[model samples]
Target: MATLSASPNPNPNPNPNFRSPTDQTDHDPESLPQMELHPSSDQDPTPNSNRNFHAVLPTPPEATAPAAAAAPSLLHISFNQDHGCFAAGIDHGFRIYNCDPFREIFRRDFDRGGGIGVVEMLFRCNILALVGGGPDPQYPPNKVMIWDDHQSRCIGELSFRSEVRSVRLRRDRIVVVLEQKIFVYNFADLKLLHQIETIANPKGLCAVSQGAGSLVLVCPGLQKGQVRVEHYASKRTKFIMAHDSRIVCFALSQDGQLLATASSKGTLVRIFNTVDGSLLQEVRRGADRAEIYSLAFSSNAQWLAVSSDKGTVHVFSLKINGGSPGIDRSQSASDPVTSPHSSLSFIKGVLPKYFSSEWSVAQFRLVEGSQYIVAFGHQKNTVVILGIDGSFYRCQFDPVNGGEMTQLEYHNFLKPEAAF
Candidate 1:
């Protein structure tokens, strides 16, 4: 899933501790033609705001109380396209960290105490899409500032009439999502390529394929329970009525060939073939409804992982292939696909749907009610989870056994002292 930003709104008030900020280098005006769409500022405009440009490290446990008084507020968090790295936007600045051997690669603090609400990274490149947020924004909430870390400046920007809900990036394109519209631009020169209209998307729900040579974009459609798939390569648009309720969250495979969606009902997650919009598989998250926070496909698309308010991360095996009729029903004790099913499944049609629904093969439990996003790790059979409560977990699942996953690592990225 892309990084979600708060709805565009004016800053409440300026932080009194902020100090004057140093000016950033101006972009070459002769570089690109001025057009209707413009970007925002990276240089802090508040002359009295404090600026603390430094590499941030975890405060010692003994200093936790004091640090809490001045700790930077987390504004946003997201994984890169490949999930090899992740970024966190804070009120003071943003920090990027490696995923596998988790470590903060670098951090940029605007001592002026400006907040970054959204940070979209293109793989691990220096280029990033940033939007201002929090009580004291670093930039206007209506603009998407393209930041170039190598130069330590904003190289370009995309301005809109309203606040930007989120931004998606690819090697060749930049996608900006508003409440009801989406704009696609050519990355090389920031030329507007296409525009799309969507339903009231306050969460800025959008997903794009990261596979090279293919452009697949998915967003909410005009009607409830609808999803729009844009296949730029084939010049085709496919709309799928994914559910009867409102779409809460969805994810596309790396190749954009498969899509998984959960609705406000949230008990069921359906996977579809992007090419034909055909139902390929359906998995149950629970008998009762729950908010599905995130869904992800393994690099090979053989497994699907889901996280929800239930404080559980469930991994389900994907057995259906594109263009195939349905899931392969042949099963045995030795079968590799180990997703659990109720023993009452024998009378599926006679019993409630819950009795026959397929359940996760493996699960990891956490504190209930906190938001967490999950993604399959680069390491095989591993899943990486990031939580709003500052928890980071990496667990390995036994594909053949199907049960509780083994916790391999844990860290409180937000409160490192807690990890100690």
Candidate 2:
């Protein structure tokens, strides 16, 4: 990607003693207060020109090739564990945004133009895990920078031999994913607790339960199309054969009691009982093969949302009862929105499997071919969609009437002018 030119900074540092991360004096005595970002007319729209406080970090050797012409300006985007907020990694730094009302909370702009490839939040907290990426990186690609927003500096760092593919955070733990390895650390002390070797995971596919008192982690098993689940509380590990092809994408429920998985085939999505590795429910995305970008289960495990390369976001109503630990089955099923099925489904076992497959209850069409991830919003009957093209959408689906979801809000988060 071509570098966007940025004008000189107008809001110079007022504190003479302030220094960037590159300075010998990396620690600050006073903590920086969180300031609500208010983009002014004079501010440049490029992320590098944001008015946020700047940090000077060490520059790493650039071994990667130039970004492609069609590369996304926003390197990465992911919601917090609770879906109340989200983090966007950009070419310069990273920005945090509120998901419900859709507002920019704060952002960090590094003076050295360090592109943050990955940013993982600990549920709208001050601490965030940052991995250097893009054509030009801010830090070494193999290092994970643990940033503390309150202190406005890196609190700790984790170095690896290979580039970090992804990072996941919990209140008590931090999980880092590599090409074929994963490291789990105690968040408070950054002490290594466990490690696992997986079949080549270039996409860094991993999911963890966010519920307290339970630690459930899902990752690729040793065999293709298999999923390994770790039940830390019970000290048990279960492997489930999820599909015929390799596992492409999967998501764990908030409680970790239920799991949703999609294989490289991308047509069928299976829900599993994490405790016993039992098949709970299965739904069909489409008859044709497509790349499954994301899968998410509603907080109550009543509905699941799936996004694919085909440009359609599908929401399927779950009919299984979550009865085990970490599962929340309190939401009454009295009111339900059923997914449409083929008219031939009425004939039991008389036609091809395609005729009996379940379809989406609600659908949202996007620009085909653009990568996007979907998450169930905190708002009742709403789904949040984030596209690599910098598009953010919040759409609400009707429970009584299911088909097309109503668009509630849309924003271009990467375009600074529109972002504000």
Candidate 3:
């Protein structure tokens, strides 16, 4: 609600270059806010910085507010299961925001070490799992500090022999991903429930369905580009050869009924039926190579949102039928890819690989490589995006037109003058 800087914006992209939209027309890029953040000394070990703006949050002795061009880059960003709120890992510490109005609800500066490299919020918001990273190194890489916001303290933690890459939280399970293994624990007691051997997952890639109906966990398999899906209730595991190249990203629907995976190629995203591992639908982000950042399935399971290094977010409408079986692998292979131009895709099989991928149903393109994360909103046709530069955007899409999404509101999380 306040401007962090008194001076003019130090950096602004005069013109942002973007590729052709996958479905709709390209529109204006949302403007970003500039802010500075510096953590001060804290006497209380675990200060609730949200309400107590003056609360002490001890930082390294030689730290100052980030300059306009030197704002901390986001290490990780995650949306809660309900999509009502989002959390981000920043240099100073971590902050949680209410998605609807796009305002900061909680701002906790890393008291001792440095910025939290990885941060994930559980269910409603009482608990948080955080790890060390960013320009400042706070906690050990091998442990996840479970912070209890209510008590304003780290009440518990999960320790591992190796660095923790990422964490996924649910009502009953805390899934922790390491370089080559996944640990699933009982949330209540933190007891080791099951351990999974995985390939070299440097990114700590893992996802768990948050539905109360059934529990499903996913992580990298032993083989490259393979995904291991574990049905906790049934106690069954299935491996799907998800990609030709190494898997880049994967997301499961709330109910675990669908799975979407992308490869290093980044051009195509494949959706599968979790039950039978059948290919459901395939969508295209573009015809070029890019790093996939995050993928999310809407709460209702009707839309899929994808963010990547290209500084663009694409939302694709899914066609899931309850009665009909998923697309047959053989028939799906021959299905004509939806090309941008009919002439270019007339012979999809013979056309270049670029043309043989299904384009996104709707797209929102920004300056290339903003490093963003996307989530479907609770209200229909809405999406939320948080950028690496600390920019937040809430937009609405028109499913019928298959066009660009419109920005509803935006905020700069770093804009508070009190951040210093």
Candidate 4:
């Protein structure tokens, strides 16, 4: 396999003492904490006096050429075991490539259909779910199709109540969250297993397998600032609340332990404990408002990659301390001694920043057992491989240092010869 690797930085802490003393307090800042201030008398006198701030600005030629040369424009990108593929969904259907060689395996066309909107892989069965629907009249609903990769045949059609926004494949079930409700169907027979109603239109849906017979739904509702989690089998609501100015996106760890949420308002990303619905860490980046559209965790549950509206992918490492920080429920009780209440404490860790870049991340996945390869889908259908610095990765599960993703492998899966 063709691999792109970077030496892991031994010390991930670019700013160890970066936290302000005020951050330890419970209150969030109303405005940006003053970094530096100048009196009116010191204000710039001329129109060009603020040139200090523009000193490093890139020239137009440099700006235009850099972005154009970074990577090829893509239609869609996905990651498999050792390969990553990019498809030009509109013109030619799909292409398959080896991640390491970056070599074209095949090029297939599904030109009869207009294009593909979403492409997802069934982790358990190794099937591909291609959803096609857009503003174009030629490509309306009923275009959703599932293909068997090994056999290379379109074996099934997925029916949805409304346009399909997201599709998640669990061990034995496929959950499709549409405009109104979430439908869970058996992957084997495509039989409806359960349906979940939503308070607001769902913008995103993520299913985390709980290993036994349970699955957790982390959904971002269309209404401003709404997010919820529901236990599918028990039909029990787990957690629901407004976390951001506009809840644009949310994601759950594969193990169903951690939940990462982001908003369209700015650079704030919050992590919560899935077991008790308690806030664990809050991360803020950049000074201006930014919209986060996608979030993903590596399969091993150690790193989180967040993509914003500005086309930037910010990656962070998950760190867990040995002991859980105790929560004081006494503040909420009318009678602390007599109230039927109990407090819970669990492990706590700092969610320090690991890596950041201007490349927009649409989707990301980690290769199982391969700590080096972390694949991500980018804007304009491109994919970029990143090298995770060693210092920034720490496993939250049993061993705490196994989450370092240091390499990337890209494959082109869509081929013209394959059935579209």
Candidate 5:
């Protein structure tokens, strides 16, 4: 079974940190103009092209107390897929934690900087991307400092014209999401590989496929309610007129074979083939409109998870065959579920659209609270939710029945000695 994860929300405008206000009204799905595509020439597949960028490292500032003085506010949190470790960004800096032992690996404090607004780790350890935070930041927000843990110094840096909303690192390339634009750089040399213009993506919504032989980048298209896909290895591109409403969420599978999307309407979620932009399946969140926090796909690409403003998470089943490496022609035939509106009865046809909107197979609900971040563990069939109040919960979902999720662990990282 596959498991997906995403950030959950509380209100119509649930996420105050990243989302720009958008008109959620549904509109006509007129065709969008396609953008020119370019293929990447390097066929090496892996981004381990250059190591010379690490030869000379800039000295780090003199160390003060890297750990928190007492209690530090949690600003942002992210998991390093390269390593099994998850990182919590605090007012002082960032803390790294190992999941297996549930212990703190090390703490990096902002000796001169104000705070760590956002921090992303590359793999297990060492390389990190840090953006300045605080009311009056010590460093320029437009500059991304590349920190090397081994030498405790800056090895390289990438500077942008505007503040970066988010950064995703792969062996071969660095994908940076800006407010309205995206920059793809050759990781080894920071060479400008591609530039993409998008909608007013204040949250910097962008996702990429890893280790999939082909480098694919998915983000908001030039038009609202559209999704743009770039195939780096083959230099091809496909545009999916995904929604008749503004897009609110996006999730890509590990291998870049599938893409999941949600619109501001929040009533339905659709899955598409990354290779050709074919509609694979469409799922529903609810009948009424709500804000969506996150969308994720399992490692195996068989399951999908969605969290929305209703403080509820729904898991949907994808008709993926267990045996075949790719699509199974018989998988859809073996399943009984079909499109929500695929009814034959006469009475059902006269009902409102809400009556035909899809429902989830399994769901987990939390008490109404602040904004929350949600995601599935990279290698485990676990759902991880992080709340604004610093509470963390990890639980497992029963694939057999799509029943109540079993709690595996919980922690409050904000309190002294409360976080593990």
Candidate 6:
């Protein structure tokens, strides 16, 4: 009953235009790391060309026979307690399959004029929301349909003037961002709750649930390089300008303590403190120009993964400690910048390790158990499953790690190599 939505690839390039003081700190160009060549980017004279470069695409597992010929395009993806499922919204309707088994379980052909686009699942209630529309000018206005998986029927329909960019469900309420406005709706009766005028064009929406209380809304504004975290109950707003270019995609940590934002012009993934909007860590990987399309945090918040347009997902481990000593204290007391350490002395550290295979990923999610990360490719229509360790599991998921995978296999896979 879990629903997943396949939206357009927010990151069309792996190198995003990220703006940071550190980016402009002025490191000599000659001191930068050397570029490595990979099969995917052998011709490109840039770093990150060697990251996750595959010589040949692997063969599909025999279990995926039914969908072998169907052009693989991700429509929606979700994880249940045991298994992960991906649905492809095609011309007929939608199809669901198990991530590990790669076997088809359900297929519905609604015959409701093809061109199905956005898909989402209401986690708490197990409802599926589907949007039917495309970019074609001839396409009719977008429409939203809620499907009751228990009965496998369309339970409700909401029509919109423009395409529905993103949707999130919080308890009895549904929040949707379309074009320039955000709408809050009561799920039970489908009544309009509140409509807020958003400054940037709303491209994505994520909600964190608080039992019986209001949820926190995370809105990623297109081309604005801004993310707004609003406490619906308190009506308080925290505006985070993390990236310099348009923020293509972002993901919130499971515990709601950290937020990861990736831009479309640079390769840096910026992590921020959810409570105070402070910069925690700056994770850098890939070519400086790789466009990051999506990002997600593991269930344990120990790991973060970023997917890009160049077809690679980079993973980083999050390290938390009492803040580092003051910059002046670390140096000499006589340093001109030396100052007394304030009460706020601690900082969080995020370190980037390496990236996985190269693929054009649109969106990704972590499974419930945190064993694997699913990344959906906009170009291949295939889901690339990368084990936290390094083993490659080719299935239909996004290219990002869903959450942290703590299994022994993953731990062993990610074990540090001995230094020379």
lDDT of 5 by residue, 1-420 (tens): 101111112113121211111212211112110111122344212222222222211222223424444677777777665335677777766667665445666665654445667777765535577776656443456756665555454444565678878888765677888888888876555556788989899887888876436688899998989999998778998999999999989988777778999999988899888778888787878877888888877666667888887888777777744322454424334432432342533465687655555556667777553666666754455777767677777777766556667777777766655543
What is the C-alpha lDDT profile of model 6 across 1-420, one tens digit per residue? 112121221222111211111233333333221111111221212221222111211222233344334443333343321124444454434544444434454444442234456555443233566665443211223556655444344445555666677666544566777777777765655556666655565454454532333466677643378887776667777889988788766776544556788777756778887567888776664545865545665454444556555545445545533221111112223311211122233321232232321222222333323334444322222444544233334423222432222221111121123111
If scored against the real structure, what TM-score would every candidate get?
0.82, 0.82, 0.77, 0.55, 0.77, 0.57
TM-score of predicted model 5?
0.77
Model 4 TM-score (2 dp): 0.55
Question: How far out, in Å, is residue 284 in model 2?
Answer: 0.5
**Candidate 1 local lDDT, 139-227, one digit each (tens):** 87887877665445554666677999999988778899999999887776666788899999999999998875579999999999999
Identify the leading candidate in terms of TM-score: 2
Scored by lDDT, model 2 comes in at 0.77
Candidate 6, residue 76: CA error in Å? 5.6
Q: Residue by residue across 1-420, what tens digits does model 4's lDDT show?
A: 000111111222122212231343422332212111111231221221221111111222223333223232233444432123422233224434433335444333442333455555533132556665434312234334554433333445554446776666654566777766776655555556666666455453554553333677776544566666776566666664547476666766655667777766756677787666777665553446765555666554444566554434445544433112332222223211111111221212232232221212122334322223233333212234422111011111112222223334332232223222
Worst 10 residues of 6 by lDDT: 13-22
In model 2, the runs with Cα more than 4 Å from the true position are 1-54, 57-72, 323-334
Candidate 3 versus the native: TM-score?
0.77
Off by over 4 Å in 6: 1-83, 100-102, 124-126, 134-141, 199-214, 221-223, 321-420
How well is each residue in 1-420 modelled by candidate 2, as lDDT tens digits? 101112232333222222332233422212221222222333232353323323653332121212212233688899988887888888877778888888777666665567899999876556678888898777777777777654556545666778899999887787999988888876655556788989999999999998755789999998999999999999999999999999999999888888999999999999999999999888999999999999998888888999999999999988786445545555445556566788889884988888998888889999889999989898899999999888899999876578899999998876654434
| CA lDDT, candidate 6, residue 119 | 54
Better of 3 and 4 by TM-score: 3
* lDDT score of residue 141 within candidate 1: 82
